[model samples]
Target: MRIAVVGTGYVGLVTGTCFAETGNTVTCVDIDQKKVDKLKGGTITIYEPGLDHLFLRNLKESRLHFTTNLAEGIKGAQIIFLALPTPPGEDGSADLSYVLGVSGQLGKILEAYAVIVDKSTVPVGTADKVRDAIGKNAKVEFDVVSNPEFLREGVAVDDFMKPDRVVIGTSSERAKALMQQLYAPFVRQGNPIVYMDERSAELTKYAANAFLAAKITFMNEIARMCERLDADVDMVRRGIGGDERIGKRFLFPGIGYGGSCFPKDVQALFKSAEDVDYDFRILRSVMEVNQEQKTYLVPKIKRYFGDLKGKHIALWGLAFKPNTDDIREAPALYIIEALLKEGARVTAFDPEAMENVKRVVGDKITFADNQYDALNGADALVIATEWSAFRTPDFEAMEGKLNKKVIFDGRNVFEGPQMKALGYYYESIGRRPVKP
Candidate 1:
């Protein structure tokens, strides 16, 4: 298979590299000359685990290539993937300018029949719009297929290589056959390739994300009630997670759900509902609850110390989740802003996301070299992202590094009983506060 993936962002890069790993010759196209040059020079641009080896191996084997020129990149390609950005617009709808603009360009230059795949997450009816855009000037036959990606950031490579289910939307038999053949290797383990109409496929992506967002928000809401009722959320989580119907995933309560997917997808889905005069009340509540949940720990932190003026706080974790350097809508940023507003100084550390955060929060707060270093001279410690490294730390070293043995655990990384035994004051979500 000859694959051309447009837009070398996180999805595009991963898609292009992973396809090339399966013995397919993939040419990735990007408008940015700098990014293309970096990838061409054997430098992997993203921080996906287990991707570097695959990318380098495929590149070394001459199966993967990168180019800034769209026409050149798509030449001799059997499948063209439009992995362009569909960022949420001011009206909360997905801005399809990038996807449509490239589709229009692809129409003019396609020399042969190709299956154009929409790998980017977009609203329903986007495939029809894309087909219309291409049909306006296309001299060659092509099929526009909606093939939304379901790759989680931390384990994107694994998700792509061994997807639970592959959703491909196309009514055309020829396009479906090609797509099926292309993805046959991935679904050999009996994982289905669900074929449906374009609109349903588009909605599937939004629906899955919205449901997960709601699940996380529901747990956070339960955590909120647990805090008032003096119930342990961890026990509740374990109690209910054992049930087969509810399942175990997305039950852990935290500050909130924030990343590239949930926030944007939920807002877009809500906006889509509004366009059809439908009142998605549950989704509306999810949005409201998640927004409040992002700064859920701020009030608790303030309650612990009545006057936060001149208080130095050390924060651990900045990424929305662990194992990736993405900080699109991380709770740590909201916490930092709220703390700064209360006249509290903050020093934070994340294994991979500090540089990205530094770009957004330039010189606003200090970024520590390490987790322990972040505690130096800090009044209290706040755990924002649950990175595996922050799970277990030398409490004696942390206690010695901090000005006070006080901790605010937003991710509930530590237990109340253990903190009490260690003679440290600890606060966590949906759990009894440990006071020493």
Candidate 2:
């Protein structure tokens, strides 16, 4: 198979590299010359786990290539994947300019019959719009298919290599057959390649992300109730997670859900509902609650210290989650902005996300070389992202660096009993505080 993937972002890069890994010839196209140059020079741009090896191997083996020219990139490709961005617009609807603009361009250049796949997460009617865009200038026959990606940030490579189920949206029998052949190697484990209408396939991606966001918000609400009623959320989570009805995943109560997918998808779904004159009440509440939950720790910090004007705080973790250096809508950014507004100085650390945070908030908060370095002369230590290294730390080393033995943990990294035994002031979500 000869394939061309446009817009070499996270999803595009992973899709191209993984497809090439399955012995298909893939040429990835990007508008940015510098990014294309970087990919050509053997540097994998994104920080996905296990992606580097595959990317490098495929590149070295001559199975993968990069180019800035879209026309040249898709010269002989059988399938063209549009993995472009659909960032939320001012009105909270997905801005489809990038996807539509590229689709229009692809129309003028395509020479043969090819399958055009919408690999980006888009709205329900985007496929029809794309088909119209291409049909305007295309002289040859081509099929536009909606095939939204379901890859998670950290484990995208594995997700692509071994998808549990591949949902493909196309009405054309010829297009469906080509897609089935292209994805046959990936679904050898009997994972069904579910075929549906284009609109349903488009809605599936939004629905999945919205539901996960709601689930996380619901647990955060439960965590709030647990705190007020003097109950432990951990116990409640475990008790309910055991039931098959409520899965264990996405049940951990945290500050909130923040990433490229969940926040944008939830908002887009809500906007899509409004466009259809339908009120999505639960999604509306989920958005409201998630915004409040992101800064859920600010009030606690203020109550603990009467004046935050001169407080020095240590914060651990900056990424939205672990194993990836993505900081889009990260909860730590919300906390840092709130703390800075209160005139408090913060020093923060994350194994992989600090550089990204530095780009967004330059010198607003000091960046520490290590987690303990962040605690030097700090009034309290606040854990934000729950990075693997922050899970277990040398408490003695942490104690020696802080001005006071106090900790405010957002990810609930430590238990009340352990903090009590350690003789430190510790506060966590939905758990009893331990006072020194």
Candidate 3:
């Protein structure tokens, strides 16, 4: 199978590389000359684990390639994947200009029948819009299939190759058969390849992300209640998670959800509802609750020092989540902005996000060399992202590094009593306060 993937972003690159790994010839097309050149040179543009190896190997084998010219790249491909960006508009609805604009271009140049798959996350009815956009000038038959990706940033390659389930939304039997055949190798583990209408398929991606966001928001609300009532959110999470209905996955109450999926999807769902003259009340509440959760540690920080002015705070993490460097809508951003406005000085550390942050938020705060260095002369340590390294650190080292033994843990990375025994003032979400 010959596949051409447009956009060459996270999803596009991963999708093209993985498809090439599975014995398909893939040409990834990007409009950015620099990015296409980088891909062509075998240098990875993203930080997805296990993707570089496959990408490099596939490129070496001549099964995978990259180009800036869309017509040249997608020339003879049987399947063309539009894994483009459908970023949120000002109104929170997904802006379909990228998808539609490319669809229009595809309509002009396509000389034969092709299966145009919408691998990007788009709003409902986008498949029809794309189909119509292309159909206007298309001389040959083409099917627009809404096959949304459910890949996580860190483990995108594995997710793409061995998804839990594959959803295809096309009424055309010919398109369905080609898609099924293309994905057959992946679902050998018996994961169902569910077929549905295009609209349902588009909504499924949004619904999944929104549900996960709602789940995280609900847990954060519980954490807030626990803080007021002297209950342990960890224990409460465990107690409820033990139930068959509430299986434990995202039960931990963190500083809200962020990155590429949850926030955008939740807002898109809300916007989609508004488009139809309906108010998605639950989703609206979910968004409000999540915004508070992101900056949930502000009050705790202020209470710790009485006054944030002239305070030196050590921030342990800055990325949205662990195992990935994405910081879009990161809780740490909200926390840092609040701290700065309160006249506090901040020193932050992350395993991989520091350089990226430096580009966008240079000199906002000092960029620490490492976790221990971040604590140097700081009043307290605030745990933002739940990075694995932050779970266990040298307690004595932390005590020695900081000017004072105070910790505000938003991710609840430590045991309350353990921190107290270590002679530090530790504050965490819905847990017993650790007093030094």
TM-score of each model, paired residue for residue = 0.99, 0.99, 0.99
Q: What is the C-alpha lDDT of each candidate?
A: 0.95, 0.94, 0.91
Candidate 3's TM-score: 0.99
- Please, what are the lDDT tens digits per residue for candidate 1 over residues 299-413? 8889989989999999999999999999999999999999999999999999999999999999999999999999999999999999999998998888789999999999999
Clashes of 1: 0
For residues 354-400, write the lDDT of model 2, one tens digit per residue. Answer: 99999999988999999989999999988889888998899999889
- TM-score, cand. 1 vs. native: 0.99
Cα error, candidate 1, residue 353 (Å): 0.6
lDDT of 2 at 128: 99
Clashing pairs in 3: none
Ranking, lDDT, top scorer first: 1, 2, 3
Maximum-lDDT candidate: 1
Query: Which regions in candidate 1 have their CA more than 4 angstroms from the true location?
Result: none
Better model by TM-score: candidate 1 vs candidate 3: 1
Q: Listing every candidate in turn, what is its Cα RMSD in Å to the true structure after a full C-alpha superposition?
A: 0.7, 0.8, 0.9
Q: Which candidate, 1 or 3, has the higher lDDT?
A: 1
